[model samples]
Target: MTLTEKTAYLKGLMEGLNTDDKVIAAIADILSDMAAEIAEIKDDVDELSEVVDVIDEDLGEVEKDIYEIDDDDDHCCCCDDDDDEDYDDYDDDEDEYEEIFDDEDLYEVTCPTCGDTICLNAAMIEDGSINCPNCNELLEFDLDDIEDEDESESEE
Candidate 1:
């Protein structure tokens, strides 16, 4: 049974006893007061629960607006485009990127001080040395030694 109903039942039982004891009368009054307070608290809790549900719905709408969430599909607004022409344009951009960078030779160099790897082209290496981007330490390259090693390897 509900707390209020249980309290009411107790009050009825106390009244039926017809006791002359002051303690029993006081206890019954206390139970009645407790029942009233519990009812008010239950009402307040229900109202707050409804307010929370409304706030949750509002927050959902705000999130949809901020993130461009579509209800129709799982994809974001940008990826929802059905046009093949837009996809073709993206492919053209990728081809242009490949054409520009495919011909150049890229070398990976590791910094001794910071242990960070950096990519460099031939023109950058021709400068003989570059400051390590991570540690600002001067890193020198001896192209003459590398050429001699290459020559020896060819002779072998």
Candidate 2:
């Protein structure tokens, strides 16, 4: 039986005993008080359990809202697997740029911090540096390094 039913049974048994001993009556009174306290504690625990269930349901709704927000976003990397398609578009743009400008006359440098590919002329690589558009980090290219490599290759 449930704890409440068991406590009720004990109370009934104590009442039926009709004991004359004062000690027995005092003990019965203490038992009654303990049973009542236990019932109150049970009620409190039930209320707390209901509150926990409601909080858990609210958390689930928040998770659904977060998912919906992600679903509505088209360019979010976490929401879709079309990152390769984005890269393909970048490649197409690069091809079109190459058709308009001679690739040999341009130097391509990728920003180390932001991975932004920047096209620079040979003169710019020698004396100029660019700040990355995406991350605003300074990017410097050393054209002397290329000249050094070429000289070493010619000596060999």
Candidate 3:
């Protein structure tokens, strides 16, 4: 039974016994006070829960607005033009690209979208792409090009 029901049952039992002891009556009074306090606490908890839900909803709206602003701001192609120049420089020095595998034999890749660092083995990279853990963005990598370069270097 609920706490209130249980308290009522206890009160009934105490009264039914017809106890003349002062302690028994005092115990009944204490149980009634406890039951009242419990009810008030429950109400307070419900109000707090409602407030939390409102805050969560507001946070979701804020995130949506931020993403919308980002989308609108993406129309400026100046950032992409800078990235193109960087890529061209990287392509010109292809021979300078060393193996990214660290001591644990895992390739450390930075997600292009979220910039989160991720570690993956050869097979995982060979799958062509993986989702970024931080932003769930699809991060593509070229395993075929790396393998081809390695094969040519070994033959030389």
Q: Write the per-residue lDDT of candidate 3 for residues 1-156, one digit (tens) a residue.
A: 877787788888988999788897888788888888999999999999999999999998899788654544554656654635646778756644344443436779998777899988877877888999899999888767878999999999
| TM-scores for all predictions | 0.44, 0.39, 0.42
How many residue pairs clash in all the candidates, one count each? 0, 0, 0
The top-ranked prediction according to lDDT is 1
C-alpha lDDT score of every prediction, in listed order:
0.87, 0.77, 0.80
Selected candidate, larger TM-score, 1 vs 3: 1
User: lDDT score, residue 31, model 3?
Assistant: 84
Off by over 4 Å in 2: 1-17, 67-80, 83-156
Task: Give the distance in Å from residue 33's predicted Cα in candidate 3 to where it truly belongs.
Answer: 0.8
The clash number for model 1 is 0
Q: How well does candidate 2 match the true structure, expressed as C-alpha RMSD?
A: 10.0
- List the pairs of residues colliding in candidate 1: none
Give a tens-digit lDDT track for model 1, residues 61-127. Answer: 9999998787877654577377456588899999987775688998999999999999887878989
Q: Which candidate number maximizes TM-score?
A: 1
lDDT head-to-head 1 vs 3, winner: 1
* Candidate rank order under lDDT: 1, 3, 2
